[model samples]
Target: MFIYASPSVERMYGATVDEVVERPIQDSMTPESFQKALQVFAEEMALEQTGAADPMRTRTIELEEYKKDGTAFWVESTLSFVRDARGKAVGVLGVSRDISKRKAAEAEKERLARINRQLQRSDSLARMAAAIAHHFNNQLQVVVGGLELAMNQVPENAKVFATLRKIREASRKASDISRTMLTYLGQISGARCAIDLCGVCKNSLPQLLASAPKTVSFETDFPQEGPVVLADGEMVRNMLANLVINAWEASGEGAGVIRIAVDTVEPAQIDSRHRFPVDWYPDDTRYGCMIVEDHGCGVIEADIEKLFEPFYTTKLMGRGMGLPALLGILRAYGGCITVGTALNQGSVFRVYLPVFQGKPSDTMPHPVSMMQQYPKNIGVLLIDDEDMVRDIAEMMLKRLGYEVIKARGGKEGIELFERHHQSIDVVISDLTMPGMNGWETLAGLRAVDPQVVVILSSGYDEAHVMEAGGPIDPPSAFLGKPYRLQDLSRCMQDVLGRFQKPSECPGDRLQNALQEMPDGAFHKNSAEGT
Candidate 1:
């Protein structure tokens, strides 16, 4: 069709005005755009014929238009129909400008907002998990401690002894579940030290292989001595175990080979797929990487983002804490994870831990012996908000041959310790209380006597308590809740052994006294001991 074309046609469509006028307008646009233009034109023509509105009224729309060389760009076009002197519709006129930059900016803003929302959700979930685990640990401590005491009182040949043992085992399993919840919240108790990924993975391989079915095998690629990261050794092994186990399960009924690898990876090489903890982003230049890849039925795209969510699993009988806890451990170590998968193809999980550049800390804790005995005249100030916990702990301390002074809260403990600072050799205080908490109590006790032995106890792990941040004065030692009699004994002995002179220590006194007293004297009840 012949029509007058503006000289600006060359600038917009990469064609001269004369050339554009010789061809249909569709040539300057993609087929989809041309079809859209036709629809708008038909609507305007119908309105003009019926006199439903002004014929020259303009309408604006954004569409993709093509240049003569076939490159496409977005344009906002204001279109109107030109009318003749008789008020009849004639030709159409349109003005369009590129809006690509504006579109990109809008998209970027939306993406940032979405990420902020995700971080908020992650924080909320972590808080809820921590609260649940903390309360559960507190109650489990009472049950576990009480069971151990009762079992000790009954003879091994008694009928009730076996039942009590079974109950204690069940309580221990429950304790493990509570620990997993804390791990998912990144509140696990473990020391972080510089460790090589290769050594950890290699050392744990035998156990991992034994746990998997014989049909599933491993293919490992590891560097000999490199790729060290600052993290907890046991937690690292746990993370690797979770990944390997998941890979094995994903391999399905057929025989499969799970590939495990460790090496140094540049930040730029990391694939953007599923990320753990939702809020983490890569910040390190180089990272120690562990890769676990499975060739069996891969994960679908829909389930990828949800893989690290607690209790979210595709399997029918899965508890779903393994991946979430793994993510928690990595998050605490200043690391991140990436996943790549395709349905029916395969899956690759890459764990990236920050490479340690400084000198590694080699200090390790000394194990306390379970047979440690307490002194005759020593006094312990036990502080806790729970009546049952206080009562059970008091009985245990008295049975262990230490005089007990019970305080219902931290404030009471501080006041009592001040009154009996010389008599109270050790202060065992619960970390979480109604007011003045364990940290405040520790500071208070230090004010009275700087050298006083204080053991901060919590249902949460020691690492979590330290991470919460308190006064400059740290406790002499930490004891996690739900501890057995042996755990309590070791904690007390360890702190006393480390801080006190050997002659003044209860353990030292017990060794000398054992020659005179009977074998069961230490295990007697508080009334019997008095």
Candidate 2:
């Protein structure tokens, strides 16, 4: 029993002094705290029974204490036994000081440390994903390129052609998976154009509904038009699918409804609730927002911070790449996501995208197209650390009617280019090589012949590679790995077309072309590397 409490107790615990005086101390403590206090008191009493307990010695304890208003706080208390005239222990004397501020500071420090650790883990996972995606995309390139070569050999009417086409499609999907892994690392490469958010969602809803279980139903609220954003349409579709699928799954095995809506939101309306890229904020005054609401098993508070982590999931057999990739996409677009949820109530995920201010071009150029024929005398220097990729690439070059010289790595490629600088009209070098990388190889080749045309190739997309600002002396062109005959041929045409003749060096011709073409017209080795 407290017997008495000072006026300070009311100030510390939000209770009046009279309300706490003469009351059982247990009433002011949590069940766990009360039990702990009882154990300590019993231990002290046992020591006192042996006459070994020092009456002047004070025992200190920190506990969570509550007051009349039910508000809890931390307090550090010191206790000593009060003695009679003959030194017999009577009552206990105790003094307590509120330590809520110190406790809160400690808690906040621990939380920041924990968040820093999570970021490090996420970074490590992202790097690992990049490495895996790099290698996987390399292999996929070979599969896709080889399949294209095989398909060309067989007539389209042949049964083998159909089989090859199916295999190629499957390989392309595999390539998408690798891209998703790269997306998680925020290294995805694709064209972005202004598109209506509501339209994209509506187009995706049919497929989403078809793929989802019958127990799940969808309710969509979309304005007829507008709320456009400058983003990759395919990636936006993938993001929508990811959110809707996650909502459906979270809705549980029983029947449930998921509501999806798109609206324009003012920047002021957005909050920082568990936003990814914690340092990011809305760059625009208005945002095109997509909200996904579900009446499923709402995310618990503990799991909210981890929802965007790659492969971290509460569900069994969850691959867990969806939300992470979505975050990556948002990060790339200078956007952010906010989450709201309560246990057993449901979750609402609001994805805010920066609104596009200008109108998109009426006609968008294709990313890849068939190449026109080039002179057979034109030569290419092909470099790669991978034997399979190099050999197949050489074959692809030859199939496009160009003389091919193969080099195992960047050093060898530079040597070959130096030896045959005049003969080699173009150099296609792999970006990730063991001894010397493509960037270093490009520099070396340019040192030998300033006009040398070098195509830097990588499993990563050209946009991602160029996003790092590229080399001081950039390559003439960028070739994404796993390219087919058409891709190789098209790149060759684009490179060679800059010059009037294949025999002459492109320096003078490039200068003339630059003079004639509009600003930003040059695609190869120019400021617009991508």
Candidate 3:
């Protein structure tokens, strides 16, 4: 079928309908009176579809059309598909008209609106920071001055040392305020596993409440059934510490109550939109939610929308990082967070985290020691790039009654191993380093003595690491960073116990190999000539 238009042709393209027969339609939409038409087209196209929509269905779009002289104007387009005798879509037809001046005016207005919002947010931050700085700075000054005075007055032998200790502790806490701000930005990275949430809470509450003003009372509602999250224990502990502590401060002095609820948040209650890019984790096990609530005055209505934006605050002043940091941590784990508050009531911050799927156990799985009793003279070579890690490991191993030798890098480690290949019981090395890595060092050690036992240690994710080529075999052992003192002690003793002087080949095997030599092999290959 064919279609046609008349007056729209002459006004839009400066040509009669005759010119449009073999010409483009974009050139036929420059008419001046189509401003109203553009609005209607925008409304229709706003119903954006996902994936492909059905054919023969109507679709509308907005575009700019050019006249013969290249003078262009905006247009509203209504499009419909043409079909074949077999009922398949063959082509599309469209009708459009001009709206150039309106488009120009709207572009200018949007530019101004965006600038206005940025200015307002910046202005709010400046005002908030000024109001809060004095109180924080004042507290810091007093803690520091008090410590100075105590240092002069308190005698070394006096029992009032306890009070001085408290003052020093308070100063250190004030120091941590800056560090905690970093935690709020989700900059902290560490390992996490399924651990007792209640236990971490109880152990951490004292720190949360310590700096809190006396007027605020803290309480918890943790169920015995256990609320668990798959996360680094210390990192989660730090996250809850920041949120709970912020709630205490928000309560303002001692007049408010902070309540923490730790229970499994039901899957049905969560709006899935909060977790964007939701395609990755289709299972509900991705996160566990924690709610931190306060019974102090609620937040202002106008401020709620911008609450989690970085550096936005309603208080006298703050790093404005608390909520933003919590959101960051959740996002890293493919999770979400939000806040709810009403003026004169209180605010509740909800945190959702991915679940940890670890070995099913009530208590942490403790690696059983392979060596129970042994003489203490065995020595081990410890190789790592970090001086602190190497020093501490060497000291710990030495204290466990074994002599410890230290190497700073892969080259040095190999040198020491080759020098004392027979004496060194086992080699411990960091996997990622300059010059060469753990795998290379292991190969160097094996070249000197194939029986050399090597263990790899690092902060890297175990699953993502590649052995590449070293030792010509899988690692004898691997330990993640921040491993326990006991675990290190046991690992050394166990690995050392497994090491033995290379034994002579079994008599039978040696004899069989000798018999299989070329001359003897000729005898076997020819049989007994019988």
In terms of TM-score, the best-performing candidate is 1
The digit string of per-residue lDDT tens for model 1 on 359-388 reads 546637666776655457566788999888
Q: Tell me how many residue pairs clash in candidate 2.
A: 1
Q: Can you tell me which runs of candidate 1 are displaced by over 4 Å? A: 1-96, 271-274, 300-302, 358-365, 501-525, 528-530
**How displaced is residue 470 in candidate 3, in Å?**
14
lDDT of 2: 0.78
lDDT of each: 0.80, 0.78, 0.60
Q: If both were scored by lDDT, which would come out higher, candidate 2 or candidate 3?
A: 2
For residue 177, model 3's alpha carbon misses the true position, in angstroms, by 11
lDDT of 2 by residue, 1-530 (tens): 66777888767777677778856777888888889888888989899899876767889998888867888888888988888999888889889998989999998898678768777887898888888877887777778877876776799999888889889888877887787778877787377788888888988988998999999998889998868888888888888889888888888999999999999999889986577776567764799999999988988888897888877887765588899999888877888889999988888999989998876433367564453555554667778888788767766666666655678888877776665566567888888888787788888888998877788888786767777535465677888767777777888888887643644753443344434433432222312110
| Cα error of candidate 1 at position 261, Å | 1.5
Who is ahead in lDDT, 1 or 2? 1
TM-score of each: 0.81, 0.81, 0.45
- Residue pairs with clashing backbones, model 2: 141-482
Residue 481 alpha-carbon offset, candidate 3, angstroms: 7.7
Error of 2 at 401 (Å): 1.8
lDDT at position 210, candidate 3 = 85
Q: Local error of candidate 2 at 104, Å?
A: 2.4
lDDT of 3 by residue, 239-272 (tens): 7977887787677765878887765555566654
